[model samples]
Structure formats: structure tokens, C-alpha cells
Target: MTPTSLNTGVNEKKRSEWLQEVSAHLVESYEVTESGKNPIKRVFFEEQEAPLSILSHVWDEYDTYAEATLHWLYELAEGQNFEVRLKVAETVGQLATYEFLPVLRKILSPWAKSGKPSVQRLAALALAVVAYNEQEHIAQQALNLVDHWSNLKTSSSLQWTAIAAYGGYIGLLVPEKALDNLKIIAQSGNGKLFSDIAKAVEKLFNAGVQIPKLHGLVLNTLREWVDQGENTSVYRLSLLIFRGLMRKSWIVKNDIRQPTLLWLAKESKDFEDPIVYLMRNGLNLGSRRDSILAEILNWLEFVDRHPTLYKTLARIIFTLAASSGNERKRMCYYLKIWSINSQTAIQILNLINKHL
Candidate 1:
């Protein structure tokens, strides 16, 4: 039979009652046992997963329950279940609040020094996410972790994961020692560590954190990556990092203009995605819609140098032109200015226009 209509049936009440029962069961099941056995029974994996899953949903619903979720997850991490610890650590990164910094730091301290690579990596990610905003309080902690992991003699996995976790410090009040450690990683050319550094900086940028100091460091590193001969992963990662930095509005476009333009000229055609992708996610530096378009406009002079990029730019303009939105409209208008200046761009626009 078809389901009863919500307005006619008591379905809402029934669902609410079911949810209440489930929440109660989850709490009872997750509570610490008198016998000291992990509250999660290995035989009932789905039942074991329920509490953490519900905790995730609770955190998503509001900030009021975040501390309770953190506390519960910290308790769960004390269990011997590998998956439970890993999942708990992962979830903590998302549900963590600044008020629980001490709890998170305590949970991470021992894992940071774990002998197991798997445990250490998971802990590193947690440490980075939890310390992301409160670098001041954990400045010494992060510094010590970076130094300890960076100097580890044996295991690249542990070292790289540790470095990546510290990536959370992108725009925060990091110590000089931390920056020095990052510089060493950047210059090391260790593929995993280098990529992790890029990922960390990217995450920071995406969080709307800005650090003008990373400009030169990133550019120099990008140049190094370029000279290493077009490793797609590294190239893509470097671009993501560049886009993040540029989005922050602190990277002096003119400083890396020549190198970047030349790189695009030689490599734009091979850049996996078209210029549309690049234009689509332009930085959100200003409150106004047109600000991003203006930022894109500033780069046209450079795009003008390489006719190869003109066609790509024209396609981007055409694709964006059809959409009727404030940002799209502004983008189309500025794109026209660039499209008209170059014959190649104009040709591409005309070709696309004829089909429409």
C-alpha cells in the first residue's frame, strides 16, 4: 500500500517516537560498561556504528551539542577497536569545538607519538583540524609535533602525515620554527610531504584564512615543481595552492605574472580542465558579485599574451554568458572586453555564438 499522507496520518508522531527510541538505545549502548569491555560489541558492527552516526547527525543539527559529542567520541577512542578509534578521530575533526581544545590535545598527544603509521596518520589529521583555529594555544604543541615528526629517522608515512597535520597553521600565528620546518619540507622534494604541504595550504585558504607571507614560499615552490617536469599530481596540487593564495587577494599578481603567464602559455593547453573551471571558482575576496569579475579582468592582460589561452578564455566566457545571474552577467561583460581584444578569442566567441 502507498504511504499515508502526512497531514492525514499520525506518521510524523510515529517517526518522532521511533527516533526517541533509537536515541535512547544509542546512549545506553555507548555507555561505559561495568566489566570494562568496550561498549561496542564486535559481533554487532552495525549496532556499534549507530552511536557515532547519530552523534554526527546531532552535531550537524546544532552547535549546542558539540561538547557532548566531543566528550563521547573521546571516550570511544579509548577502546581497543581500530575502526572505532579511527572513525572517532575522523569525526572529532568535524564536530570539534574550540572549548574542547584541551581534550583534543590530550587525545592527540600520545597518538602523535604512536608506533603505528595508521594510527599516527589519523591522529595527525585530527590534530591539524582541531588546532586549525587555535594555533596560539597549541603553538608550542604544533611546533613540537612538527619538529618531532620532521626529525623522525625512520618512516616517511609518519613524517609526511605529521607535516600535513601541521598544515592547519597556514594563516595562523605559527612560530618561526614551524615555518622553518615547512620550508625544509618544501625544499626537500619528497613527493608525499610536498603534496601534503600543498594540501594543507589549500585547506587553510579554503577556510578563508590569508597569509601574505606564504606568497614567495609558494611561488618558489611552484617554480621548483614546474622545473621538475610536469608531474600532473604535483601540477594540479600546485595550481590548487596557487588558486587558494590568489583567492586571498594578497598574492601580488605582478610578482609571479611573468613566470605564471609563461607557465600557462607552455602548459595551459595541457591543464586537464578548460579555463571555464578556473573562471568558475574565482576568489570571493569582496562582498560584491562584481569584485571577482574585476579580479578576473585584471588577469586579461596576461591572457592576451598567449593566443593559445584566448580560445579557452572565449569558451569560458560563452559558457558563463548564457547564465542569467549577477555574477554571470558581470563575468560575461568583462569577458567581452577581453574577447574583443584578441582575434583568436573573438573567433572562438563567434563560432560558439553561431551554434547558439
Candidate 2:
């Protein structure tokens, strides 16, 4: 045998061994202890740190071995270990590139069609990541696959997954298309599906996926949904979706924040639930706490004008204050310095002391 051919065979054997070793380690690392926890609950909530670390190391060390690595991951993905398979699916999406499109589709397609809802959802997310590829054909294939799964005839679980995947990644290539699809979906009046759709919007903002006028486009679409006065389900769902966006409002550009908050405050004037939800959860303000607090303070003025909303708003504030000393101090400081000329404001202030 030729020396070169012998050396090539040796390298192939070594690569195969390495792939097997890494794959086994990943699976072992992710093996969850049977802690008497609900199997489904454990599957979704358990942290698989060791496997994630090993995967990160593998990528750092063997990025050039893309084909072999992807194949090994695919094998693991098809394995019986649910945790490892889920992480592998995520890694496949994370590493998606134009060159890997064929294998990525191969790795994801079966899972996308799996009878298991969890498997389908993970595959949908991986497909969304694939759609982020810059090559139009690669991106289009991923989008089409997800769009196909989103058809009305599909299982509701799979449909929700497809809609979420589309919502999360379509903006990467075509923001306008994403907005249009989302608006249409929102207008469909599928009350249960809106939560998943809202999650997708949250994922988009969390990933910092920028599109010009994203806030305006989203808000306008929501305004239209809310204005369809006959659909109370649509209205409630729209507010819930708006709450999700508002949590991430701190990440939005400064120039856009004020107008967005103003619009939200105006729209929210007649409703109490959204305000209660926000106050209970608190805003994700990062470092812009003061600025967001000021905006929320401005919102409180609307609560002042609407006497019915005052008790609930005040109760939420009282609950928040009672839960944390820092929150209590913060609420007190803001309420004291702000002009509390209105009667509702005074009543809310009076409620704070009762809670303390």
C-alpha cells in the first residue's frame, strides 16, 4: 500500500475515534439523575452544564472538523438521551452556515416531524437558526420548511413551533416579511397561540435583531389588533404581547423609547391588567432603571385619571414594596418627589403605608 494512503487511513481512524469519544462524553455528561421529578418537567428545566461545556470546547478545538463534528452531533441527536439530543439540536442551529445547509437539514428534518412536541419545538428553533444564514437559498429553504410546518392542518403544537421559529428568525433576512406574517398570525384570533408568538417576539428583541422601525411596526400592528373591538380575546392577547415587548423596551433605542412609552400609556389607560402584570414582573431595565422608572411614572398619571384602575395599581405597588426593602424605598422616593396632586395618587400613596 502507498505510504500516503496508509497515513490517510490512520488519520480517518483517529478522527472517528475522537468523534466517538467526544460524543460519548457529551451524552454521559448530560445524563440526568432520576430524582423523582416529572420526566417532562425534568426534560425542559434541567441544566446540562457538562455537555454544554464539552460542546463549547469541541467547537473551540475542532472547528475545522465541521463535517465529522456535525455528523457526530447528528448521531447524538438521534439517540435516546433527550437532554443530549436537545443540546445537540441547539448546537446544530448555532453552527449553521451555507456549507452546512444539507447536513443541517438532514439533522433537523426528522426531529421537526417527530411525534414528540419537545423534539418538534427544538427542531423548529434549530431551523430558525439555519434561516439566519446569509445565503438566500439556504435561508429560504429553512424558512420554507418552517412555513410548511406552520400550515393550518398541522398539529397545533407543531404549528405553534413553526410560527415561533418564523417569528424569531425571519427578521434576520426580511424584517418586513416577519412583521407582515406576525400581524396576520396575531389577527387570526388564536388566543392560545399568542403566548408562543409573544415568546418569539421576546426572543427577537433579546437577540438584538435590529430592523428599522421595528418598534413602530410592532406597535402599529398591535394597535390594529386592539382596535378590533369585537375581539376581546385579541385585545387581551395583544396587551400580553405588548407586555412582553415592554419588558425589553430598555434595549430599544433612546429616540424611540419616549414615543413608544407614550403610545403604550395612552393605549393602556382603559386597561389595568397589563400595568399589573408589568409591575408584578418589573421591567428589564438593565442600567437604564431611572429613565424607565420615569416613563412608568408618567404611566401612573394615566392610572390617576382612571379611578377604577387605581386600587389594583396601588395594590400591585404595595405588594411590590412589601416584598423588598429596596423596592419600598424606590417606590417611596419616586412617589414622594413626583407631583401627587391627583386624588388617586394620594390614595395609592396611602396604600403604601398600609402594606409596610
Candidate 3:
């Protein structure tokens, strides 16, 4: 047999064994009905797995031993049993309360320090569940864990696990200090982790927990990631976060807006060549160019003092103009708005006229 087929066979056999083992444990944990219509066997059928809703129903009916079940689920969450553990994590989140806070912490704390990336991620995901469920007190602990994982220096994957957990669980709280660490990680040259961090930033939006001054932090982090050449995904994801914040008008203060524009302009000095390359070569920029121009216009209105970014801004605008459709027209409108009022805008207009 081929090696691929052999490995598949082995994996299937192992999965079968694991299912049998778990099913038997579940059945044994509860008394069997005379007709053998027990909830455990019913929910966890022979290769006819039920959805999370059904599993939750089963747990509700047999909740007399919830504490035992919670412990059982925690054990399952510690392994590579993704199907079992995902359900277990959900169940644990459902079962978790203020009383079990310490228990959950004890279960999650050790995994934060050492384990396979999957296990660590799930463990942190469980914590994220707790965080999402309104346990903001644990925010400090999770923030500490993020810091701890980041300082390990030997394991970028672990750092990502922590960041992912924070994104999933506590990034809404995105404590100012944690943002500092996240910015550092964005610039650490770990492409995969930065991608995951981008995803985490995406999750932060989903979590809908508002951080104070989150826009400034996100913009600053985006600039640092772009400057460090972390990866395009990081920039793209960060841009999504920025756009979302802007659309919501969350970062409304003129002070916040002006300084951020200046920061982007200042940071542009460090990445002229790379930005040029992206302008010329970026495949994804077409879809994203409109939003990019909108941001540039917003910055141009406030960025007259930062002359250094004028040339860089001009390069970005013209390159985007090279794209087709209304995006080109939108860039032209912003170019006109800037050219009439500001030197930097006039400079951007001149550069675009000369180049494209």
C-alpha cells in the first residue's frame, strides 16, 4: 500500500478506537435505561454524530453530574481529539460560572506555558469563551499570559497561541499594555504568527468589546507591521479593522485623527521601496484600493505638516489610479480635493501627473 493510504488507514483506526473509548465512558458515567434509550448513547451514536445543540440537550437532561462532566470535558480539551474537544470546550463554556472561575483558570494556566500548539490554542480558546461570556476579571490574567508567551522568544507558535486566545477571548479588553506587546509581535518577522495575529484582530472586531483608543493602537500596529514587512495578510487584516473603526466613527476625536495621519506619513519614510513594489505588483489592491484612497484622503486633510509623506502618498494614489473602474475616479476626486488646498496635496498631484 502507498504511504499516504497507510497513514490514512492508521488514522481511521485510531479515530475508531478513540470514539469507542469515549462512548463507553459516557455510557458508563450514566445509568443505562432498561430499553437502552440513554441520553449518552443517543447523542453520541454509532457514527451518527449530533450537532452541538443536541449534545447540549443531552447535557441538560443529565446535568445531575455536571461537575464530573465539566472535568471530563476539560480532560478531553487537553488532547488532539478535535471533534470531542471542540464540543467539550463548548459544553464547558456553557457549564462555566463564576464559581468555576478558579477551576477553569487552573485548567487553562498550565497549558499556556507548554504543550502542542493545538492544545494550547484550544485551552486559550476555552479561556476566550469565558472572557466572551462576561468574565472581564480574567482579562488581567489572560493579558499576563500573552506577555509570558511573548517573552519566551523560542516559540513563535506559542506566542501566536496566546495572541489567538486573546483575540478569541479577551482582545476586546485589548488592554493598552497588551497592544504594546501585539505591536512588537507584529514586527517580530514571524510571518505565520503575524497572519494569525491579523486573524485575531479580525476576531476582536467580532467580539464587539470596545477598547479605549483602540483605533490609534490599530493604526500604529498596522504601520509597524507594514514597516517590518511582516506579511501582506497582516496589513490587509489591519486595514479591515481600520475601516471598520472608521465606519463606526469610533475614533472620532480630531486629536486622534491628526496624530494617526502624521504617524502614517512619518512611517512612510521607512518603506518607500516596498510600498512602490506593492503599488506595482499587489494583486489584492484592486479590491482594497477604494478604502485605501479614502484613508489617504482623510490623512491628506490633516497631514499638511508632514511633507515627507507627500511623495509616498502621491505614489500610492497614482498606482491605484492605474486600476480600472470607479476606483480610478474616486482617486481622482481625492487628488483634486487635496491639490486645491494643500502643498502636500499639490505635491501629490504633481507627482501623479508626472508619473501616470
CA lDDT of every candidate: 0.50, 0.57, 0.54
Q: Which candidate gets the maximum TM-score versus the true structure?
A: 2
Better of 1 and 3 by TM-score: 3
Clashing pairs in 2: none
Q: Give the TM-score of candidate 2.
A: 0.49
What is the C-alpha lDDT profile of model 3 across 1-356, one tens digit per residue? Answer: 99999888777756447656545223323323446534443235544444444555655687675566555655665432356667656555444433345445545554555556666777666655555655556444445556777665577766776676656545665545555666567656676675566566655533332543443454455555454443554555555545543333322243443333334334554434333334332234556556655555665765576454455566556666666655466556667776777666776666656665
**Could you tell me every candidate's TM-score relative to the true structure?**
0.36, 0.49, 0.42
On lDDT, who's better, 1 or 3? 3
For residues 5-103, could you state the per-residue lDDT of candidate 2 as single tens digits? 998877775643655654532221333344532233122223445455665576667768756876776655443466556566667776654345555
> Which ranges of candidate 1 are over 4 A from the true structure?
1-110, 113-118, 125-138, 169-171, 175-180, 186-194, 205-217, 220-356
- Tens digit of lDDT per residue, candidate 1, span 119-203? 5666665655555645555444544555776666465655665665655542244534444465555555566566567666555
For model 1, give the 10-residue run with minimal summed lDDT: 280-289
Residue 300 C-alpha lDDT in model 3: 71
lDDT, candidate 2, equals 0.57
Q: Model 3, poorest ten-residue lDDT window?
A: 24-33
Clash counts for the predictions, in order: 0, 0, 1
